[model samples]
Target chain A: MSKSLSYSSITKKIVLSLAGLFLISFLVVHLLINMLILFDDNRELFNAAAHFMATNPLIQVFQYVLFFGFILHIVLGLIIQIQNWLARPVRYNRKGYSELSYFSKFMIHTGAIIFIFLIIHFANFFVIAKFGHIDPITYDSGNTYEDLGLLIIKLFEDGIYVIFYVISILLLGFHLDHGFQSAFQSLGINHSRYTPFIKTFGTLFSAVITLGFISIPLVIYFF
Target chain B: MDLTLKIWRQPSTDEKGKFVDYQVQDISADASFLEMLDVLNEQLVVNDEDPVAFDHDCREGICGACSLYINGRPHGPDKGITTCQMHMRRFKDGETIVIEPWRAKPFPVIKDLMVDRTAFDEIIRAGGYISVGTGGMPDANAIPIPKRDADIAMDAASCIGCGACVAACKNASAMLFVAAKVSQFAMLPQGKVEARERVQNMVSKMDELGFGNCSNTYACEAECPKEISVSHIARMNREFFSSKLISEKEK
Candidate 1:
């Protein structure tokens, strides 16, 4: 009963994991930029960072790369998900299926919500700030479009958008809480002694990402 | 001691199953878990009531026929033991035990706590073998397998093809079981000739049988009676990928 190869299942997992890691790196950079809003009161430095990101030649190139990376990540994630769904077409009807961690079972739901959030996030911040007309603010170097503060304030002022943002951030936390260490394990990094530490690190990273993003709306609404 | 049991009962594979409660009294704490079931069955037979159906063969824990998802954990609360090997002492005097068949879609229940685990057999039939023909026994020392490889093969061979790995997995994945089978054969000299084909065929059969993909949660390893390492899954991935590469090169 010698079997033949269908496809490389691991390749799909590896692709999804690498893409997730890339997105994590993007999160770190994005967080660094957002944290600057806390520092410069006048919004000049924020605008400068925005301008550099939008207009600088190297960053412009990187932006295209990031876009491609995001697309690849989403496509690979969906492919893996579809394959998984096809593999087990039937749903378990029994209760207490959540004996395993609730977060692990709800990954698909969390992932879908995060996907929707990413779309809204890109439309609101990236598209409006990049291509759409926003209020212009004059800086020492030059003039850069700068309505992000106003946009943030307006979005948060609407309680619905605020709620959606909060919920999405929470779901993102849930996704990362599992995804972080899972990606490591998928790449064969599971030493029993190190796995606990890695899981803790993963939890910390999820908390940071969730709290960091949630703070932006809080800062806008409160301050 | 009186024990309350909520056992899942289904007439056939087509009909939906539901939990039915039964009570048994004065059961000894030291009885093996299957013996407790036997006591219940004896009561049923005497009373002329239909006895609860469950799967068990050796009762010594070697045959792997005893499969029960008891109280949210596979094979009761104890680790490193099958359901048949579990003792009644694990439960309190008046405690209630919830028993159900393995809940994977591939392992459909034919009766109370008895599931059709033939999907596993089908997957094994798909590729779990070496094509070498049986002949007279060769020289004892000839074609020696390295100590490490032999040890690993033994570890992999420890799997009993029980559906516990699938039952224990959050995704109901058969990866650990399939990996164990593939690795057991792949480690031996006779199996080397068909290693690539074996992995590929077994994986295809696994997929065709509607077992979910492994999500690397390690739940399979956690609930496995044999404590099969997740590393075997990694090996399966490596073997499958390399086989694909080699096959592509041939093309």
Candidate 2:
């Protein structure tokens, strides 16, 4: 029993929605920067964007915010999942599972898988680029920075890792399928007219973003 | 119509229960669902066996008393109807039916297929009422409510306190039930005066009673006998927000 559980859970819903929406925006930004990999002769373009993201003062602050968003979303999701489990102490004898959509039924499952993927991804990329060893590259005259672009290309070149990335990205789609529309609904921004649009766009957004992320690994592996 | 029934039976609240299979024969296609249950109960009584216990009062979909999860949907397969209103014709002649009680921590089984839904009563007591003055009946048009508001209020007021929404919800959330009560009053001027405290009190009590928060799954509304819209939940969210906002401003 958490102390905060006594108050109205509306606060938790609002916070979860806000944090989730923030992370959603972060995904778009991340995809835009990561998309630069598809360009020709663009190690500089992608690396510079990555360097700016890592070192820019505003982005530096936002990096911490992004980390906080991840922590808050995961914690809130776990708490809500546990609360739901506790709420239904008994399971129905038959035919209950067919009632909920696959995405709705496995939200916690997808979220947990995404969390595990995030841990591995951050440790492999973010931590190394931040503190651990990465070979530095020098430009025209003076500037030298970690070659995160090269590290990413190298990581994605491995077929096993690429397969894992593809599967994880699809799992992220499952998470986003329910989460995007659900966030708006939780925050009380729903309407009869716009709700359908929101659901459609959320599905579209999740699918495109998933394919975009998966494209990076596939291109690096096969192309 | 012949049917195979898989029914849950529990002797008491603490005892473990299991699904017992029974074959019912020569059932009329037009018989109501509860009437079919009556036919089965009659057989049990004839054989000198204990009859299955279930709760029903009005038996006309008005009373929330009839609570049964039929074939994974609350109140049976048919939509916009309670257990009492569901008919045997909804199923195929040889179809097998699975029946169970509403399984949630707040709702415990008092007997086979009958759960103690006093949790809903507790929520209503929290703040689902307006304090009114004692007086003789006044003119109905005195308040001069707008047609739109009155219709919405009526729609919300139709909630029969059936735990179907709770039983149908994947999280076993009572959002539909509480939101209906909250909205029933939030729309009418009579309920507006206590809106702030009403939303706050009722939601807290719902949580304290172990009802899960709304995941917006919509299963509750899908299986609801009254067909109460999930929009009430969004409205309740707004009410809760304003409640917090106004009370904070007063401080």
Candidate 3:
């Protein structure tokens, strides 16, 4: 940290950005796993994969790292937000102001919505899969495992949960759409020639993530 | 061209302001925006009504004194161009344009479109200068700054302190202004000696002056007539952090 730097603002941003990128990487891994559900003719393969993720020691360690990252990311984001609010301490009452883009102005609002979505997601998937009593399933080899497929079906069967999943995925997509390229710019990766490409890549990635996640619920609900 | 102008008229900083309307007829489209204002003021003087008071010195746009929020933009709709350089042709005939002073708390209205931008002067006094002793001008080649660094430093130095950055900022931050000054000197060999103190003092002063914090919206860069990069803000952060760390270690 530079002595002259206002760490409260800049460091918070750096931390949030790096952690955000880490979480995005985690999301890619997660999306890949969930997409495996689409591949399995039966629910057995998906359940086995879920079982391995839950039981593998190395995977457990990775989960802990992810948990820490989430905590740090959220804490830093909150601190920065509070400090920014404190710094302003007043509001303008002008009727007509201009030059602000719609997306630029609503970052915090979108961020808060995403935060709520994460909490709901964790409760539905992580907590239930890890600690909650799941229905039993017997494999062809006579080994019994927790039925993650049934849990997913139950969660998506409800019309409200389906709506929630779609809304959350959309908000996540919106957040990632802005956050992906913004992180690169903040880290000083700006080369005018490559920025447009990066932005395009970010948009495509966010769209894919959103479409992939939303597909799971949509498939379960309709099928 | 004929135009209807709704100009802000505040008797003083303490008084409530109101928009006074004026119609100007047969103005040249090629006339600069300030020249159009000048013609309006000239007519006002002849009519014995108080002329609209605005600040301008170098009509060439170098002085950073002409600050106007034309139709809600800091320096008007044109990108990388100051108000003095903007011409009347940018507007259609019979258009009603609203002109207001820079609306930041730190930059209080002095009169019509003129503002007391002494906050900038104060931030400079807080340490925007190299503290080297008076001596004969050294040869430019003696410093031997890397070409890349020199170019970056010159880019930062191009900030004209027009208060456009502050006005464009949603939070009305002076970070872009202060960062430009800090980064310009911090980059050069001549400025390296006092880099620590320069950034520290200037930033602290900026905070002290009630300037809002940057939220990374990039509005300042968008509306800046000089187009100073937001990268300078990052450099300012880097300098301030490292300097504070070094001083802490010494302590």
Give RMSD to native, each candidate.
Answer: 3.9, 1.6, 3.8
Candidate 3 lDDT, tens digit per residue, B118-168?
Answer: 999999998888877789987768767888998999999999999998887
**Model 2 steric clash pairs:** none
The TM-scores, one per candidate, come to 0.86, 0.96, 0.85
DockQ of all models, two decimals each: 0.31, 0.64, 0.22
**Per-residue lDDT value at B107 in model 1:** 84
Error of 1 at B10 (Å): 1.7
Q: How does residue B144 of candidate 3 score in lDDT?
A: 79
| lDDT (tens digit, per residue) of candidate 2 on B96-121 | 99999998999999999999999999
lDDT of each: 0.80, 0.88, 0.80
- Winning model by TM-score: 2
- As for candidate 2, its interface RMSD to one decimal place is 1.8
Give me the candidate number with maximum DockQ.
2
Ranking by lDDT: 2, 3, 1
Candidates' chain B TM-scores in the order shown: 0.96, 0.97, 0.96
Scored against the true structure, residue A194 in model 1 reaches a CA lDDT of 87
Model 2 scores a TM of 0.96
Instruction: For residue B103, give model 1's deviation from the true position in Å.
Output: 1.8
Cα error, residue A88 of model 1, in Å, equals 6.8
